[model samples]
Target: MGTAMTNPAVAALIARSHRLGADPRTTNYAGGNTSAKGAGTDPVTGEPVELLWVKGSGGDLGTLTENGLAVLRLDRLRALPGVYPGVEREDEMVAAFDYCLHGRGGAAPSIDTAMHGLVDVPHVDHLHPDAGIAIATAADGPALTEEIFGDRVLWVDWRRPGFQLGLDIAAVQRANPQAIGVILGGHGITAWGATSDECEANSQEIIGIAARYIADKGKEAPFGPRIIKNLDKTVRRTKAADLFPIIRGLASTDRPQVGHFTDDDVVLDFVGSERLKELAALGTSCPDHFLRTKVKPLVLDTAPDAPLDEVTTRLKELHEAYRADYRAYYDRHATPDSPAIRGADPAIVLVPGIGMFSFGANKQTARVAGEFYVNAINVMRGAEAISRYAPIDEAEKFRIEYWSLEEAKLQRMPKPKPLSTRVAFVTGGGSGIGRAIALRLAAEGACVVVADRDAATAETVAREIGGTDAAISVTADVTDAAAVEAAVNEAVLAFGGVDLIVNNAGLSISKPLLETTEQDWDLQHDVMAKGSFLVAKAAARILIAQGMGGDIVYISSKNSLFAGPDNVAYGAAKADQAHQVRLLAAELGAFGVRVNGINPDGVVRGSGIFAGGWGAQRAAVYGVPEERLGEFYAQRTLLKREVLPEHVANAVFVLTAGDLSHTTGLHIPVDAGVAAAFLR
Candidate 1:
């Protein structure tokens, strides 16, 4: 038979890791690691030698590939236990691992590499499966595991991941030679076998054992009625949609944190239970969750129906108290031997009847935390059903949360994009200039809301962008006050709050002064003037409540500054809207909301107004073919370059990204240097 070092063996191992990691029930995002022992030719010397290909730190196993695995000399890694006579320092041990790399590329191997190496097997799978965690965190976890798996499994106490953890696992393996797996109390599970298939099978078998055990215990009855009563009361008195903005604003930092509000029936039921405080105070279900969610979630005192200003004040006070409590936890846990750890505040916030909110540096991180918490709720519920939920004690949580090894993993993470955690609202986002802006903002890592008058078109744009976690579609008529209000509320519900608002919904009209009807004038002003006001007013309320200073940009036109012949109604409305931008900026400057405008001339292509027959009529009046109309405007500018929709979007990005943070109430011409439209 071919040895485990064969190419097929390695390929099978990689495939198994991807499959296990892809399921959140098996592994949370980037939370698990896998390894396989094999022999391969050294890239430098071309000599056949034993090696360990392990999942690298910070690589998501769900989408892991060959490059995501780091290759290290097996003999060198196994020798690590002998090289250090006593407990090894984290930094020195990491340096030694770095020295043993067989190749120069790929990320550093997972911090748990030594643990995987100590196992006496060809294949190893380490996972934080929800079912396994549910069983492992129970008060009688070890007893339950023994009852379910007999001699097949061993239990290891919680130890910070490093040299010590490997030593503990090795000790367990020494006593139980027949053991196929080991459960790390308050941590996760590890399974090993001689082949990739065996390793995967062992994991599934162990998980099934625990899952059935929990299922047979039956459900906890008290949790349901209490939760339903609280949730119903909260919903009756207060709307989650109304308080989301306030919570988002108070939770934000200078880096612009985002909130993901989820009231999924399961989550609401969990948060509404009478034992929420007790369950939350029990600590995280697993050690891996500590890094992403902190020690425990912050439970807010405000309810859904509370007054807006009153709730905002309460949140600020609660957040300050939460920070103080974290500092206290750090001080009590720090010792002469403790690693230098930064104070990490709560990443999840519980809002009673409203459900829970997860905060992160970016949308993906927030969503990842949200997923972990949801799993945690299930695990806690299961543990409560069978017995008391007993997670690692506070000191153990501190050791893992502040472990130098875990801190090193964070240092290796990539830097985020400029607009990483900000949220943007784009009106008329289904197409044209609005569509371009939405795409650009999303690319910069901001969660975007595509708001348009057409519901289907907005949904198409949102699908093209992605889902609710990344983007959502809201149908809104900017000219209608109630619709505009609903749009802002929807955005808040979808992404917690709004950081940027792009007012780009407008129509155009061209006619001689004598031929211009009152109806035509009203139509132009209603969309250009009234629409901009309604959208801005709705967004400003949330921004001011948040106290985080936001951005608003109106897509104006050159007709505002330089009126052309036979365009009375269009020019008048555009000019009025531009002046309104200045007044709004002056008033909102106190609240840190900057209002700006961009004026683009003759953007014929990809424009809804131009495509709706206006371009052809305008071209005929100018005695130019419709195809050449873009060039006609291009030649009129000093730079003589066509002003594409992208150009206007770029300017919008500049204003919203704080490039011109100090300058507001200004209109920058994106018309390739239209001299007549120059502000100066």
Candidate 2:
């Protein structure tokens, strides 16, 4: 990227694509494709040949790089129409593209390849801008296109993307030499140019014209006033948190899913509108929208102010009906060759006066699906303003949804990590073993909630894991019951619900039997024992409500078993925590929540407890130098090697990541063989 790119034509193409993609009005993420055709020397023949570089399948235009481009011989690609067996068998052309490749062909070509190669222009940009789609999906789209652009921009009826659609667009372009672009009915927009600059400009111009036309000609109050005005922000968020776990449970009936929640005013407006039910039932207008969001959302039927009991009951009934409807839809269109129905659960759910919730295999996919639906909402608003909103036929949607090529893409996804679709909530995650545990869980593909008293450090660790979609930070003093409950609510609000709860917050104070004060005893027990109980108790509600089964882990210490001098309070507190593992495991088994504990001795390198004066106190007690205490502790162990945070993190992974799914109420020692503290 930084001086790595060599080809000027490809460079211009990428730059233009980024410009178009950077604006949300231009395209949604991973929705559009761009291409550049230029001269390249044939390797064996050493003759100048025409080469086409197009955005590869499943790649986003804004983030696209040269490696994301599929290069093919223009002559061979343009020749495909001759051999094309028409629309029914146009899918076979995707396989034939490999033969047209120049060298290895940077990335796999998408079905839209023909749309780029067959065009006579040097550059082509196909986008799904909201305003353009509004015009494309309007009932009077063809007539509106004729009236607004006056023939410079033409119209094409709804056609599923394939080699046939590509040929069709090319035919329209050739028929009207004066036309700059064409509005794809019920899809998006495609603009071509003599050069890369012209192509990008034309794409922007088309989008601008459509936007201006909609704004000037659009009718007011198209959604027919707000049916339920937004609830107060604080109240709305609380309601969202309450509903999220329930919705997540219903959504995951088919497969375990991660969820995302949004309460932006734009989303609030749409959900609260009088037309919400009618428009949502018609489904999203754009192909990309429904592809991620499913054909339509499961909209809550009651007013947002409905009592919680009433709303939850209604939601469950709606979910059941929705799944039944979805299965019937699948049965209606599926043939022998159709890709198997992935899931009957709705990906998007709408609650009036509250917010929208979306679900997917991971956080980013769920979040993006929400964003695409927001785009669809905007499209619907504009279309209804100018004319009635009209999407493609449902049969056509089923064709694209169950297409074998789409299935191949699904099959091509790399195997998920062991912890994929799991969300972990780690207290004391800003530092020490908790930080290490959070990092490990994220690396293994779990969304993380890094909760700590230190706001800055918690956010830093969360940022390290990756931003909003992967991990989020919540600041809370674990000892406070209210704070613990609120933090769990934050996790529910952020990632729908928690799958793993790690009670790792603690502080150590060393004192002999007679010198230990009541304050020290209460502080240690309150933090390590009661704090763990509060966190587990609060998160267990969401886990139980989700009905998805989860894990609760305690980072207890080897001192819980070993009698250590000058550590009466800390040791007793950890011992209390250790027993809680078995107790909770027994009580929670019926709910499918596994409880486990990891006991590690003297994890000195990155120990928050050791760093906070415990090292020097223990050193003084053992008659060793403060700096040498770690070595002293290691020498006394059977393995004679110091245990570390990473070692404890590995133990956490093993206990929860499927291998030990059947093992619970277990305390696995990670003390490098401390015989005295070994589990019996």
Which 10-residue span in candidate 2 carries the lowest summed lDDT? 1-10
**Reference-based TM-score, model 2:** 0.98
Q: Please report the candidate that would top TM-score against the real structure.
A: 2
Question: TM-scores across all candidates?
Answer: 0.93, 0.98
Global lDDT scores for all candidate models: 0.81, 0.91
Q: After superposition, how far is residue 581 of candidate 2 from its true place, in Å?
A: 1.2
Q: List where candidate 2 sits over 4 angstroms from the true fold.
A: 1-4
Q: What pairs collide in candidate 2?
A: none
Candidate 1 lDDT over residue span 486-605, tens digit each: 889888867778989998988877778998999999998888899999999999988987778888888989989996877888889889889989999999999998999999997898
Candidate 2 at residue 280, lDDT? 93
User: What overall lDDT, based on C-alpha atoms, would model 2 receive against the true structure?
Assistant: 0.91
Superposed on all Cα atoms, the candidates' RMSDs to the truth, in angstroms, are 2.9, 1.4
